[model samples]
Target: MILYTPLANTDIFPADNAVFTKRHCVSYQNKQFFVEETDKGDFQVLQLLSTDPQDFLRQEFNPGTIIKEH
Candidate 1:
């Protein structure tokens, strides 16, 4: 089946409530990041919410990169 709506996929088919529980908004390096808790107790970068373009260029903030707590 094809979906033609301009709305986002999540908006069309809402995600599981448990999925949101794993996600968190964290501040790292003075930047806000949307991260998800991993099985290893590390946070994985989901989305980078920053106004600076340079933040996007940083590999550390890239999606899928795991952020381990020191």
Candidate 2:
């Protein structure tokens, strides 16, 4: 089996109205990505990376569950 590492903390995700927060997003290699909202709800995803995280990054708050990174 082959395991892949995610490029987290990289300047790949973009911030937009769709995104709840648009605070600290940077640009690199002429690419942009964002934590997007899909029909399935919110997902912390990259711009165009086929690689999936080894495991999901999630957190629990008073409101409920929030995926910190995935």
Candidate 3:
């Protein structure tokens, strides 16, 4: 499984350094990804937890779950 965080903007802002307090879990083709909206109201991928399709089918995989990098 590959984890990826998509960049919303190339230009860095001071606020970008701030931790994301609110985030949403999204699934595409059974892959789960974490996304949060920036101050600019643009959606950005905070983290990508799993790329495995079967992982998304698990009961533990739900929305509003906090994902962190190890």
Candidate 4:
């Protein structure tokens, strides 16, 4: 099949279910984020799902940033 898009391959064809267990889609400050669970029981920002370009400029949503769940 031919897929024409800018998304990464992994985003199109996902891997095993086990790989998704560590990841989660969370909503914070009215923004959606894909985060991964860290060993310290914190959520590490993986990707920001937003249409606003300004959201990307925010430091908090940057990948690799860690967040603690309340």
Ranking by lDDT: 1, 4, 3, 2
Task: List where candidate 3 sits over 4 angstroms from the true fold.
Answer: 1-22, 38-42, 51-70
Query: Residue 6 lDDT in model 4?
Result: 100
TM-score of each: 0.79, 0.18, 0.32, 0.72
Off by over 4 Å in 4: 1-17
How well is each residue in 1-70 modelled by candidate 3, as lDDT tens digits? Answer: 5545575443333355445454566664456677775555544555557857677566544553333331
Best by TM-score: 1
**Candidate 2 has what TM-score?**
0.18
lDDT of 1 by residue, 1-70 (tens): 9978889998677777788889999988888999999988999999999889988999989999999876
lDDT of each: 0.90, 0.35, 0.55, 0.90
Worst 10 residues of 2 by lDDT: 58-67
Show where candidate 1 strays beyond 4 Å: 1-5, 8-15
lDDT tens digits, residues 1-70, model 2?
5545575533345454445553233232332333344445444344332233422332221122222432
What overall lDDT, based on C-alpha atoms, would model 4 receive against the true structure? Answer: 0.90
Better of 1 and 2 by TM-score: 1
Answer with 2 or 3, whichever has the higher lDDT.
3
**Model 4 lDDT-worst window of ten:** 11-20
Clashing pairs in 2: 12-33, 13-33, 14-33
